[model samples]
Target chain A: MQDSTATNARDAGRAAQRAAEARPVRIAIDAMGGDHGPEVVIPGAAMALQRHPQMRFVIYGDAAQVEPLLDGHPALKAASAFTHTDVSIKMDEKPSQALRLGRYKSSMWRAIQAVRDDEADACLSAGNTGALMAMSMFCLKTMPQVERPAIAAIWPTVRGESIVLDVGASIGADASHYVNLAVLGAAMARIVFDMERPGVGLLNVGREEIKGIEAVKEAGRTLREANLPNLDYRGFVEGDDIGKGTVDVVVTEGFTGNIALKTAEGTAKQIGEYLRSAMGRTWRAKLGYLLARPAFDALRAKMDPSRANGGVFLGLEGVVIKSHGGADVKGVAAAIDIAYDMAHYQLMRTIRDMLDETPIATAS
Target chain B: MQDSTATNARDAGRAAQRAAEARPVRIAIDAMGGDHGPEVVIPGAAMALQRHPQMRFVIYGDAAQVEPLLDGHPALKAASAFTHTDVSIKMDEKPSQALRLGRYKSSMWRAIQAVRDDEADACLSAGNTGALMAMSMFCLKTMPQVERPAIAAIWPTVRGESIVLDVGASIGADASHYVNLAVLGAAMARIVFDMERPGVGLLNVGREEIKGIEAVKEAGRTLREANLPNLDYRGFVEGDDIGKGTVDVVVTEGFTGNIALKTAEGTAKQIGEYLRSAMGRTWRAKLGYLLARPAFDALRAKMDPSRANGGVFLGLEGVVIKSHGGADVKGVAAAIDIAYDMAHYQLMRTIRDMLDETPIATAS
Candidate 1:
């Protein structure tokens, strides 16, 4: 009976080891990125480790600052491999200037470089978006057939969530750039939503074919003609359609996309302000708010911007996730969660496969 | 004592008559416009007349349909002179097609023509925006020194309201067009908000000078260099700034402005849905909601889109207020209120004066 029990235990141990070996989703982090830097990033990483036990991290920052923060979370400390770097990119620094000054030496660059070197499956940063993009484009380069990279955000909608691409990657995009965005966004949507053929939409002022800018019209025409295999081209979607979750992927040039994203955020904030002021106006209202606090908590959870923190840098050869510069620990953790998921799902391979399947005539 | 009272009464009557003559803000209405047409328009006009007793309307529509509706509102019927037109612009007709078919004979055309011919101070229509803009442009012609007419909306912000221009008037704008928008938007702001020099901001992806498209950057440069007397050019503003009321006038190309407006609407709707679902989840929440119903009602009133219904057609030879096509009676009334306000304040005169004051070198 003892021998049989030992054999069963051995078998269980072997299975656990194999699972651990197979699920190593390594993420490189720029520890000195956001406003709080190591204070938020270290705690965020620790929290992420709790959720994803199999995930590993290569954290880049000044050793003196980051090591002390890591000491607070022993489990994360055990799972992480620390890389020391004294240099850090400034939040206000221009992209071109940052690239010149902090290329190979900065924490931001090294984190991205780790992904390029295949030491880390993905890179996560809450740094200057322009600088990060510049470094990412310079280091990782664009994927085959991609002219420019885009930032794809998981936008919360009435019907769960949708992917919105080019949320401030670059300002202007041509017809083909929009098509590329549609393709890249669809690829991300598939992995994130676990859908084989995600519905892709071009974000425009109106849904009519002749209503938008010439570039958008041309992109729509191209998307309709190609009828890409990996994605379902759903044609034009208006601004309101985004919140309605009318499509799985909303594609647009960065200028409009960025404006739309910020506008939504601002609107959400404005409504929140209204709600607070309304509930505090009278004693009866205050009492009601107190009684319905739990419900409000749930509503708050649904509206929490931190839950939708990460923006994946699409069309790049290596995976990179950008978190908001002002993100708290929870926001940073959410970003890490996205990085882990992307790496675990082999996002690059999926993107490559999808791109290969896309007909070259339509993509260009 | 009886003789003195009689004299006072006679003096009061003459003063009232003079005030009526001075405050004649004639508004021409396309009664066949909007989803419900005369059903909403007649009642809306009656409501506006209740608020502004001196206001008169030249209502244009199929007399058979509109006359009965007008009969229901005795006060509006008394104040308004009905104009019969069997032709009306369809909601779905393309701009060019609507112009071709509806010009000269359509209700929409007659209402705008009234403004151009000096029979009415302003024109109000809730019909197709594209069609209305096309007809207004063709009939009224662009004002001197104006390149393209732009639609300006009164956007509700946490801090009162802000004026956002080019809300789907036209798609693309050059640097000069943006400057035109800023100038035109500021002129409207002066009349609407009663400000001497409204703070104007150019909308962009970032507040930084280097961030946006070239046209926007160029506009910023021109505004700064000119430092026009009628507007306080406050560099650049972002999407979030619009809701925060960072500037009195938010200027952008029509495409982005329209999207921002719709996105805000969608976000507001989304939040309302979330609030409803949250309140319905538990008995406790329901009870709390019941108690706080008044507070929620007040919040609803504050967030009501109807209050901010009018989009003033700026850069036109005459004032034209465009209401949302799907607007209810209350929304239509709000639009009429804007038309009355604009006409009473002599909006076109303000625009002409502001344009004359602008440095020709910078304006061009």
Candidate 2:
């Protein structure tokens, strides 16, 4: 018994040493962000650390508020584990104005700054989306040849998953901006979906070239002219195609993208509510529900928004991810994982390199 | 007993006559327009007629195809109950070009022409939406003082229901178009929801007046200046508000509105699939599904596109309802009913009077 105990201790120590030598990837999280703030953010960071011990986190917020949430987590206190930056960004303020006014002390601003200063590899926030985009653009700046930055969100589709660009970053953009969005989205799909050459589709009212407004027609022409290498430009796609996943990347202006994202969310919730009500109405249905419980749980797990928490603001100088404001701890953890994945993929460097080689012409 | 039976028959016939006299409104249906042609459209029209025997229908399509579908339906074939016009519109042609090229022979064009000739009160179609909008615009022209036409769709919500305007009519409209949509939508809500003063919200990326593209912001200002008496101008609303029923009427340009509507449909389908899968994975969930089946069915029935088949194109001089191309018999029935309602409310006349009172000032 004594010999076995000694062997176990030694093995544990060796495992610890190997983990320490792995050099944990640093992620900067806006702790004072989101509706729930540090209460949700800190625990999520701790949870992520528990799952990925090789990931180090820089929590940017009021240390006083965040430290209390880490009270009993010993692993979070390790030398190579956690760090905190005292700052935060308000959820209600105008994004551009907030970034300009609270440059130094705001948690969103500080998180982006950490990535720029090389203190952290990537930044994640669940704060004001506008403010985060503004800060990311001002601090890290856009990629060398990119016209404007775009936010890309993963839409849960029936076939699998698809990426929608410019969910709520730059509004009223021209055709050039849409072309940039397609390129950036393609880069994201390559990293996220492991596709060498991603299929790109321009979101329009209809599949026909003459169907949509002038902007969509112009964007289609620009995308064709750009002749992006790793992007297979599929002509045009309607709203239903977003879920069909026929195209890997769907590009549109921020206004349309934001509306599409929110509408999808609202419709999902409505349908779920409808199903619940339908199943509750009859005894025979109740029996069917019992027989189908496991499948239902599996479906719920697959569709859970918490599993798909992070949205990346692409075409910027650094890796910046935005989580939903209403996200819980599980969602925050998922966002952290996304930030890690982005860092592992070296997203910023890849975008910068791609932009350097291709000089995208701005629409006059 | 013989005398009583004769008296009862006479009383029933008298009651039917009273109902018919009370139902003064008539709706024109383009029966040969949809994918299913008269097979589905005739049955749907019959269903509507059965529900409201007083309602008269003017069927326009291929008489050979429509007549067989109504063979055994005595009431549908009654001379006082039905009128038929033989013509057809192909689905693939461009709406404007189709209207200009085929107006003399097309069933859809003739249906709208009938409304103009005062033979029918309103026109409904399950054919191409673009063609319907174009034909209505050309045949009816814009309301005396309106600048552009818009489309409005009633979307079901958790709380109740909300109206979204400019679904796909006026693709590249200016600020004035959005304001017109708001005014038109508010008028619709007053009739549909029976609200004396409907709350109108301008759809934007954010709730702030300063947010959104230049067109939206400019429209917001125009809406404010209009000071519509029966409109409670709610400043701004996001996409989530569509299903939340936060406001009675939501106004946006055609581009954003079309995307939002399609996204909602896609997401509802996705959520339904997710729930089905989840229910199949576990015994407990399967049982729960059985218990909840009736409630789920009810919810689905409410959210089903088939139940809400038709959308009204507003700001035109006459009523033009567009039904989903994939609509089945049941969907066709609902669309016919919607057409009846529009005519009953004198929706076109109401819009014309409103516009005439407040003549739209066209910007040079």
| Candidate 1: segments with Cα more than 4 A from true spot | A1-23, A362-364, B1-23, B362-364
Give the number of the best model, judged by DockQ: 1
Runs of candidate 2 with Cα error greater than 4 angstroms are: A1-23, A79-87, A225-227, A280-291, A356-364, B1-23, B79-87, B281-291, B356-364
lDDT tens string, model 2, B1-364?
1234334433443443344346576777787777887788778888888877877777777777777777857677672234455447777878867877768667788778878776777788888888888888888877644568888998888878888988878775677777777778887887788887799998888888778888788888876777777778888889988888889999888888988888888777767676667666666775666666666667668878888788988877568888888899898888888888777765654554444333346421
In the range A168-211, model 2's lDDT, one tens digit per residue, is 88886777787778878888888888887789998888999887
* True-structure Cα RMSD, model 2: 10.9
lDDT, each prediction? 0.88, 0.76
DockQ of each two-chain model: 0.65, 0.43
Q: Give the distance in Å from residue B67's predicted Cα in candidate 1 to where it truly belongs.
A: 0.3
Residue-wise lDDT of candidate 1 within B18-96, one digit each (tens)?
4435768899999988988988988998998999998989999998999999989998999989989979999999999
